[model samples]
Target: MNALSDPEPQRSIDVAAVSALDEPNRRRLYDYVSGRGGPATRDEASDALQIPRQTAAFHLDKLADVGLLDVEFERRTGRSGPGAGRPAKLYRRAERDIRVNLPERSYELAGQLLAQAVDEAESSGESPRTVLARLASQLGHDIGHQTGGSDRQLLETLERCGYEPRVEADDIALVNCPFHKLARTHRQLVCGMNLHLVDGLVTAAECPQRHARLDPRDGYCCVRIGTTTD
Candidate 1:
C-alpha cells in the first residue's frame, strides 16, 4: 500500500523495556516491589533484596525511566509534622505491558480486525467472512495505491506487518506468521483469513503476475506468494 509506516518505534521500545530486566539487581528490585499490593519504598526494597540503599534507588529509578515501574512519592510514616522529611520515593509495577517476541507476532491486531468485521457484518446483514475479506483487501489495495503498486513496496508493507518475507526466484515465502500462536488452535480460520488478506494485498498492489496461495509447511507460515498460472 502507500509507503509502509515503520514498525521500529514499538519494537524498539518493547525491546528496551524487556532488556531492562537483564540487569540482575534491577530485575530483583522490580520483582520485589511489584509483588506487593502497595508501592515499595527504597528502604523496603533494599532491605528485602540485601542490596545497598543507594544501589536499589538507582535501579528502581532506572526501571521507572524505562516504564517498567511506576514511581510515586509518599510518607511511609503516619506523622505529617514539620519535622517530617521529604516524601519517600515509592516503586510499583507500571500498568503498561511489554512483550518482546522474536519475529514479532500480532495476533491481537488480527483478532481486533476480525471481531470488528464480525460485528459490522452482523449489524449490516452481510456475510462475516465476506465483510472481513473485503476490509482486509481494501487495506491492501489502499496501501498498494499509496506505495505506487511496486513489488518492493508490497514486500516492505508485509515486512512491517511482521511477515518476514523471503524472496525466491518467482515467489515470496513468509518465514514468520504474525498470528503464530493463534493459528495453532484456530489453524483453518486464521490461515484462511491470512490467505485472503494477502491475496487482497497482492491484487490491490496490482501484481497480477503473483497471488497468495496456501502452502502450509512445517516451520514456515501457511501463505506464500506464487506466480499465477495463465
Candidate 2:
C-alpha cells in the first residue's frame, strides 16, 4: 500500500469576495491588478484606467478587504530608513482560487485520487484498478477516522463529501454522486472505486449493522449502505 496525505479541506465560494467585484470600478481595478504581472500602486491603476485617484483607492481597498486582491507595502524608490517616505501600498491578485458551482461538485477530488492511483501503479508495477481501489479505501478510512467512528459521523462525512446521503429506515441511499460525470463515462471503474471507498468508511466507522454493496439504480449512487442482519 502506498502512503497518501489527506486531501485539502474543500472551500466554498467566498460570496463577499465575489460580490465585491460587482461594482464596475472595483471589477476594473481587479482586472488591472491581475493583468499587470506585478503589484500595482493606486496612482498606476488610476492613470491606466482613467479613474479618479480617490475612486481607485476606495475600490482597491474594498477589493483587498474582501480578499479579492492581496496588499503589500514597499518603497518603490529603493530608499532606506527614516530618510525614505512611507512605503507605498500595492495591490496584486490573490493566490486563493475561487470557484462557484451549483449543487456543489468535487471533480477535483476525484481527479486527484485517479492521478495518484496511476502514478502509484506505474511506479510499483501494480494494476491501476487495484491501486485505485486501495487509494479510495484509504481516503474513506481517513475521513471516517477524522469524523469519529459513529453512524451519525458517517452520514455527516458523506454529506460533507457531497454524497447527499438519504436515510431510509436503517439503510442510507445517496442521491448525488460527487463524481457524476466521470462515473457516467467510466461506470465500472468509478463505481468500483466508490464501493470500496464507502465500504472502507463503514468498516472504519465500526458500523456493524451497516453493509455497503453495489445496488445500482437510476438517479442514485451505485453503492448503497444497507442494514446488516444477524
Candidate 3:
C-alpha cells in the first residue's frame, strides 16, 4: 500500500520478554546503552559505571547473549593511523531493541526530557516541526555512524529503541513503537517525544525538507540502503 494510505494498528510487546530483564546489572546496562550509542569494552564499562571490568563484561555479555546487544571483533584503530596486531571485540546496541520495561516513573522522566528537547529545538529559531526534523536527522546520522552506515542497521537500532518502521514508499516509511503501551497507561508525553526523536533521526538522514514537516500535535515519529530511493 502507498504511504498516504491508512496504516495497520500495532501491537504491544510481550510482557514476559520484558520481565526477563529485571536484574540490577542488566537494568543499569540497558540505561547506559540506550542513553548513548556505544559498543563499550569491559574496561570502559567498568570505568564509567564504577564496576570491575570482569563484572561489567559479565553483565554486558549477558545482555548480548539475550540478543539485546551486538558483539563482534573490533580491531582497535589507532588515532595516529598506525597498525595493530589483533582487533578487540566490541559490543554495541543490537538492531532489534529489547523493549525492556523499566520502572513506571521513567515515563515522567522521559516527559521532562521531551519538553526540554522540544524547547531547545524551538529556541534555536526554527519552527517546532523544523526543530523536530533536525533532531531526527541528527539521531539517524548518529545511529548510522554507530552502525557503520547501514540504513537497515539504523532501522534495527530504532526498533530496539521502540520505533518499528517498515518500508512504505521510496521516500516514505511507516513507524510503530511498542512503547505506546506506556503512553496509553501513564498519559506520558515521552512516547510522543520519542516519536519525535525517531522522526528527527529519519529527517536528519533521509529527508531534510520532510523533517521540517514534523510537528508535535500528533506526537510520535526511517531509511533504505543503496537504492538512491527515498
Candidate 4:
C-alpha cells in the first residue's frame, strides 16, 4: 500500500492520558479532571461530562480502583440534602509521588542506545533537534497503529519508550532528548549506543524509515507524517 494510504490510527496521540485507563468511560474521567487536580462530587463530574449520574459514578469507581483518582468523604449538602447526617464521597486525581522502576536490562539498553543517537547526529553534522523530530515521527507511527482518537496516548507511549515529553497545553507537547543532551555534554560511548536504540525502535515499530539518517541544514528530520503543522 502507498505510505500515504497506510493507516496508523495511533499516531500523534498523548500517551499519558491513556495510561491506567482501559475503558473509554474511565479515560474520559481522566481528561475531565486534568489540570484541575481538586476534588469533585458525582453531580459535578456528571454535569461536566454530560453523562448520566449513574454512568459517571461507574466510571469514577473504576478510576478510584486503579489509583488514578483519590477518594474522600466530604459533606455534599446540609439540612434539606444528603449531608444532614454524614459526609458524602468525593473524587480527585491522585497526586502522590509515583515511582516507575525500569528493569536493569531495559535501562542498560536504553542508555546505550540513546548514547548512539547523539554520536551519529554529531558525526553527520545534524542538530539534535532534527534527529529528535525524526524520532518523534517514528514514534507517531508506532503509536498511530496501536490506537487512535487521542494525542495523549501517543505522548505517553513515547515517554514509556524513554523519551521525556512535556505537555505544553491540551494538544501540543515537546520531548527533550536526554541522550542528545548527554552527547552534547559528555560526547562519549553512550551517545552512539542511544542513537542505535532509537533507530531500532523506529524500525521495529515499522515506521516509514528503516533507518533515520541525519539532515543537518534544516534542523528538522525527513520522516514526514501528515499533519497541519510542523
Candidate 5:
C-alpha cells in the first residue's frame, strides 16, 4: 500500500519500542542482533557480547516484546521430531522502520508524494507542479473520506496528518506544518501543494462554507482554513 494509505499502527512509531532501547544492555543487544545477517539465538548473543545467558535472554525478550525484534523458534542441529532437542528461540531485527521525531514530521510521506508526482508528470507530459497539486488533493480527499467526511472531524483528520489545527474564532489555523523544512526551501511548491491538499479535504468533508487559502502567517501553516466571508 502507498505510505498515505498504510494502516495507522504501521505508519506510526511505537514509543515503547524506542524506550526499550534506552537501557544500555538492551541497546547493545539490539545493535548486535541488527548487525547480524541472520537471526541470533540467546546463547550466541550472550557468548559474542560476553554477557550472561540469562541477561541476554532478558534483553532480547524485552526487545521482542516492544516489536523492535522478531522472534522465531528452530532446531539448530538441522533435525526435527522427538529426541532432536527443543527448538532454540532466535531474535532478528523487525522489518518495520521505526522513527521518532519531536513534534512529529512526515518528510517520508512528502518524499513519496513528490516522487509520484514527478513520475506521473513525466509519463503524462504534464507540469510537475500541476500533477503534485492533483495528487495532494486526492490524498486529502481520501483522508477526509476515511474520517467519515464530516465538518466536526476536520480538525481530527488534520491533526492526524500532522497539520496541528487550531481554532481561532470562525477560522481554523494550522499551527504546525508537516513539511516545515521542505516548505522553507521550496515555499511556492510546498505551500501550493498544502493549499490544494486542504482544499480537497474541505471539499470532501462537505464543508462548502469553509475555504482554504494562502494566508502565509508566521509560525503557522501557509494555508489557513477560513469561512467563505474571509
Candidate 6:
C-alpha cells in the first residue's frame, strides 16, 4: 500500500517498557538476559544477576508485561510426556525496537516511506530521487489537508512530525530535523526531499505568500518557510 495514501497514524512507543528499565535490579536482569541471546530461565537469571529466584521471576515478568521481553514455557529438564514436572518459564529479548525521543519524532516512519518509494522506483525503472520527492510531497500534502488548509495548520503539522518549527521575524525556522541522522549522511537527497515536502504542505494549505526554501543552518533543518520573493 502507498504509505502516503494511508492515514498518518501516530506511532506510539511502549512507555511502560522504557519505564521498567528505571529499576536498577530489573535493569541488571534485563542486561544479563539480553546478552545471553538465548531463553533464560528464572534460576539462570537469578544466578547470573546474583538475585533471588523469586526476585528474578518478578522482574522478568514485569519486563514481559511491558513487551520488553518474550516469555515462553518450556521443559529444559529433558523430561516431556508422562511424569514430567511443570514447564519452566523462559525469558528472552522481544523482537522489538524501542525508541523514545522527545517531542515524538517519526524518523522511522519517514525512513520507511522513503525506503518503500525507492523500492517501488527500482521495480518500475523510474528515477529513485523523483519517486522519493513525489512520495514525500504527497505525504506532507496529506498531513496538511488533514490539519486544515491554513499556514498555522501547516506549521502545527510540521511540529507534530518533529520539525520543531519556530517563528522568526518574517519566516518560520525548523529547530529540529526529524531526519537529522539521515540528513547528515545523505544531505542532498534528504534535503531535496524535505524541500519538496514542505512545498507540498504550503501548496495544500493554500499559502502562496510563503514558500519553502533550502536555507541550511548550523543546527536546524535545511528547509525553511519564508515569504515568497515573487
- Best model number under TM-score: 5
lDDT string for model 2 (1-230, tens) is 22244323223236777777789988888877764536899999999999999999999999888777889999988999988999999998765545552234578888998999999999999999999999999988887677665678888988888777878667788766777778888999999999988888888888778889998876577888998871
Q: How far is candidate 1 from the true structure (C-alpha RMSD, Å)?
A: 16.6
lDDT pick, better of 2 and 6: 2
Off by over 4 Å in 4: 1-20, 78-83, 97-230
Query: How well is each residue in 14-35 modelled by candidate 1, as lDDT tens digits?
Result: 7887888899998878767654
Weakest 10 consecutive residues of candidate 2 by summed lDDT: 1-10
Q: Rank by lDDT, descending?
A: 5, 2, 6, 1, 3, 4
Name the runs in model 5 displaced over 4 angstroms: 1-99, 148-150
The best candidate in terms of lDDT: 5
* Per-residue accuracy of model 3 over 183-227 as CA lDDT, tens digit each: 555433434445555555554455333432222223133122213
**For model 2, what is the C-alpha lDDT against the true structure?**
0.81
For candidate 6, lDDT tens digit of each residue in 33-84? 6545368999999998788999999999998987778899998789889889
Worst ten in a row by lDDT for model 5: 95-104
lDDT of each: 0.78, 0.81, 0.51, 0.50, 0.83, 0.79
Model 5 C-alpha lDDT per residue in residues 1-230, reported as the tens digit of each score: 77668767654447888888899999999877765647899999999999999999999999998888899999999998899999999998775446664234688888999999999999999999999999999988987676654556888888788777877789888876778789888999999988988899888887777889999876577999999897
The predicted structure with the larger TM-score, 4 or 5, is 5
Better of 2 and 5 by TM-score: 5
Alpha-carbon deviation at 90 in model 5, angstroms? 52
lDDT of 2 at 70: 83
- The segments of candidate 2 whose C-alpha lies over 4 angstroms from its true place after superposition are 1-99
What TM-score goes with each of the models? Answer: 0.55, 0.55, 0.38, 0.35, 0.56, 0.55
